[model samples]
Target: MSNQVCAPALAIRRCCSDDVHHMLPLMRQLRYPTTPSVLKERLTMLEGHEQLCSLVAEVDGVVVGTIFLKQHQTHDMMKPVTSITALVVDEKHRGTGIGKRLLLEAETWGKERGSSQMFVSVAGDNNITSKSFYEYSGFTCTGYRLSKPLA
Candidate 1:
C-alpha cells in the first residue's frame, strides 16, 4: 500500500495545568473575560471531567494558543452537541495557523467523544475578526443573540 498521511502544520497537544501561565497572556489578548484565578479554577474543573477537552498549540516549547471543548449534557430531541469555547491565539501569531490547529484538535477531540455538532457563541457585532475566522474555518452562522438592558 502507498503511504498517505495527514499532518498538522503545528504541534497540538492536550493542555495541562503547567500551560496556564503561558495561556493567560493569550487569553487576555483575546479579551476573554477569565481572570487568572478563574482560569485556574476552570482548568481544575476540566481536570476532573472526562467529557471536557482542553487543547494547546505549541511551537518550540512555547504555548501560542488554546481551545476548550465541553460536551453538553442537554439533548436537542435526544441528539448530542458539543460547545467550543475560549479559542485564543496570541496577537502576533493570529494568522499563522496556530488558532486553526487548536480548533482542529478540539473538534477531533469532541468528535471522538461522541459529539455530532459543534457550537460557539460569538458577540454579535463586536468580534468581526472572529466571525470571519469562524466562517473561514467552515462553521456556518446558525443563530443569533439579542438582549436589552434591565434598567
Candidate 2:
C-alpha cells in the first residue's frame, strides 16, 4: 500500500449509523471488505449490543482509523474485561496519533464500564509493527493463540 496520508485534522467519536458510509472504505483498507448495506446492518447490531463499541477516527470527514472493542466476562476475573476485536489504521495515516487516540477511547470506555483488564489477540504471523505498537501502548505478552483448520 502507498503512504498517501489524508490531512491531519482528527475527530474521534462513537460511530453513528450514518458513519457507515465513511467507514466502509476504511474497512476495505483493513482488508475486510464489505458493502455499505451490510456495514450499516452490522453497525446497527453493534449499536444495540452493550458488549460492543465501534469507534472511528476521521480526518476532514474521512475515516483513518477504527477500533472495535468488546466487553468480556470470565469466571477467573470478577470484573469485566475489555477485548479489542479489531484495530486498524489506514496505511496513509500510520505514525500519526490517530490509532492511539482511537485505542484510548476504547480503553476509557472499558474503564468507565467496570473493566478490570483489557487485551487484544494478535496473530503470530502478523506484522511486527502492529505487535510493537501494542507493546509500546502498554500491552504485555500473556500467551500464544493456537489455531488449526478443520476439514
Candidate 3:
C-alpha cells in the first residue's frame, strides 16, 4: 500500500528501517516484549516478505501508531486470511481516528492480498478495551480464543 494522508495532520504509510528506533518504544508502550535487537530482527524479516504488512501512522512526522499484519493460507479456508498481529495507537492519539484509518487500510491490504477474512485477537478474556473498537468496526464475536500452556 501507498502512503495516504487521512487528515491535515495525519499520514499513514509502510514502516521502514528508519522507523525502527521510533517503533520499538511504541511497542514497549503497549507492553510488547521486545528489545532493540529483537525488534530489528523482526523488522528485517518483514523486509521483502510477501506475506507481511506493517504500517505506521504519523502525525506531522512523529510516529504515533503502528500495526503489523500477516497474510497466509489455511487448510480450513480456501482464500488467504490476514491476521492483525499487533495494532497500537498512542494513548494520546486514541479516539482521533488513527486506529480506524489503520483498520480500513488493513482491510484494503487484505483484499489486495486475496484474503477472504481479516482476523485479530485481543490478549485476554477480561480485556474489553479493544473489543468495542473491533465490534464497532464490524467484527463479530464468532467464538472465544482458548489457550493453555503445556510447559
User: What is the TM-score of each predicted model, taking all chains together?
Assistant: 0.81, 0.86, 0.89
Please write out the lDDT profile of model 3 over residues 37-150, one tens digit for every residue: 888888888877889989899998999999999999999999999999989998888999999999999898899989999999887542597888999999987888788999
Off by over 4 Å in 1: 1-9, 33-35, 124-126, 147-151
lDDT of each: 0.79, 0.86, 0.88
Best by TM-score: 3
In candidate 3, which residue pairs get closer than 3 Å at backbone N, Cα or C atoms, i.e. clash? none
Instruction: Report lDDT (Cα) of residue 87, candidate 1.
Output: 85
Model 2 ranges with Cα > 4 A deviation: 1-7, 148-151
Which of 2 and 3 is ahead in lDDT? 3
The number of clashing residue pairs in model 3 is 0
lDDT leader = 3
lDDT of 1: 0.79
* Candidate 2 per-residue lDDT over residues 49-112, each given as its tens digit: 7899999898887877889999989999999999998888888888888888988899899999
TM-score, candidate 3, is 0.89
Q: Where does candidate 3 stray beyond 4 Å?
A: 1-8
Please say which candidate is ahead in TM-score: 1 or 2.
Answer: 2
What would you estimate as the lDDT of candidate 2?
Answer: 0.86
